[model samples]
Target: MGNNLWKDTWLMTVRNIKTTLRNPFSFIPNLIISAFFLLVYEGGLSGISQLPTFEGANYLAFILPVSIVSAAIGGAGGAGQSIVKDIENGFFSRLLLTPASRLAIVLGPIIAGMLQLVVQTLLIIGIAFLLGLEVVTGFGGILFVLLIAVGWGLAFAGYSAGVALRTGNAQAAQAGTFIFFPLIFLSTTFVPYDLIEAQWLKIAATINPTTYIFESMRTALIDGWVFWDLMQGVFAILIVCTITITFAAVSAKKAVSRG
Candidate 1:
């Protein structure tokens, strides 16, 4: 049974990846938006680095991780949107009739989406480097940044997938991802937590999981390895994943029964 699950997952994952590749329109927007944010923010907010607290800091490097992390979180909508299409066109119902393990079928697209997100993150990072952004931790930081991106991507993909499975509405699935947009901006997107003078926003940023993840990647890019900060990011990812994955699993089961 375990071997069959693995085989089913691999086949489904391959199919989903192939489908995504065949239809470039599905993911091109994500890449474009990520790159656009990186360029716009790096250009517009570059002066933020001139502040006393940011002395000698390169704003592009400081904000590079923001683009990577945002891509992971926002890029997940593609998975949900794809699933909604499957549900709409009756593909999901047909797949449910197969002998494939339900768990494997549910996991396949999420994993495929995560792999896509990782690639996007790498591409964005490469662009940043081309734009003169430098990582203090050098090449090793890329690995760490990828790890964090994967965690967040997987979590959000699962959450998005859950919404798709439950609603079977493309717009709802896509709109569900938007609910997180505020989380992105409410955090330390513009400035560091300590430097954020707005008391209310600072309070929100303190409790925001995005802040920890951002700081973790920032540490890798600008401050070198900080074991504590990285671990905090990992813990935050795990917590979010725990909620999102459980939601996905339950939604998958419900979807199967409804079909």
Candidate 2:
């Protein structure tokens, strides 16, 4: 309700961005880890796409979404860790003393993490491009892919920020963020859900929301501008954000009360 509420959040986000840029090495690992998995999987699992289920599919295109998802997770996890550091170092306490919106403190990391993901997303996609993955949707599609990456990153950042405020524990926040990886794998990370032969894995993938996120990204990369996939991805992000950010915002409020 404050007139300058957004200004505070933007300044907070800028502060976090400067902190991240000061230590450039922190940003490098996310790109490296994503590229490593992309290359390693392309080398080892290229043949998997030859199966009847794949039926003329491109494996690199198939896994590009996976790589981007990994990149998003890494960036989101880093955001949470940085928030924990601030909380530990008493900077968060300093913020609590200001009339700045509590929402600003909670949202600053989400905005910074999303902005950081823009760079990481481009890195993952650039590597994919160098390795011979072509975007069927061309320039517009490329931008759309970036949007999907941001959505997922925003969702993850919300969850991470919530965990950081809830526990104020670095280890717990890291573990909480890492737990989302299992959901990624359980969804269609390595193979198509219909192509998966394992009954249990198939069932889990069927139920997992990330499967739709991957499907949306994959559809954008290969199938051009399909309205359904884009809509599905947006809705999935809404579900995740509604749960994570809502919880995170509430958790942040509670943390302030406790502080």
Candidate 3:
């Protein structure tokens, strides 16, 4: 059963990747959007380097993780959209009759999203290097940040896939992804947590999972490994992932029943 599960998941993951490559239009726009954010911050927000949050560090470096995080979550949007497409076309129904592992059906697309997130992260980092942002953690740090970013993408993808399974509607999946943006935006995204003076905003940021993820990424990129600090973010990820995967599992089972 274990071998079958792994094989099924791997094959489904490969299928999702192939489908994505064949239709680049599905998710390429997400990378473009992330690039736009990175560029805007690089040019327009350079002045924020003086803010207490950054404390004289290059603004681009401080916000690079923000842009990467944006891209990571965008991958989930892509996953959700794909699931909707599958559901709309009766593809999911066919899969339900197959001998494939049930969880694999849901997880395969998410693993693809993780791959997308990791690749996007590397490209963004390369762009940063080109634009004169120094990577303080080097190759090891690059790998570390990639793992962290991909974990985030997988976690968020669970929520996205959950919504897609529940609604089976493209628009709902897209809207749900939009809802994810504000939570991260409200957090200490633009500045450090200590610099946030607004009490309500600070509290929201404190509670947001991405805040810890962003802080951990920043630390990995600029401050070194710091396992203890990174674990907080990991814990947040586990919580979010657990909740969403559970939701997705339930929704998927419901979908099977309805079909």
By TM-score, the best candidate is 1
RMSD to true structure for each model, in Å: 1.8, 2.0, 2.3
lDDT of each: 0.85, 0.85, 0.81
lDDT of 1 by residue, 128-238 (tens): 989998888888988998999899888888889999999999878878987677668888887887788889998888888888888898888888888997788899999
Per-residue CA lDDT of model 2 for 51-160, tens digit only, reads 88876778998998888988887787667877888898999999888888877877787788888898898988998989998888888888888888888888888888
Q: Is candidate 1 or candidate 3 better by TM-score?
A: 1
lDDT of 1: 0.85
RMSD of 1: 1.8
Q: Candidate 3 clashing pairs?
A: none
* Regions of candidate 2 where Cα sits further than 4 Å from its true position: 1-3
Q: How many backbone clashes does candidate 1 have?
A: 0
Put down candidate 3 lDDT per residue, 55-113, tens digits, no spaces.
56777777888888888888766777788888999998898878788878877887887
The segments of candidate 3 whose C-alpha lies over 4 angstroms from its true place after superposition are 1-3, 51-53
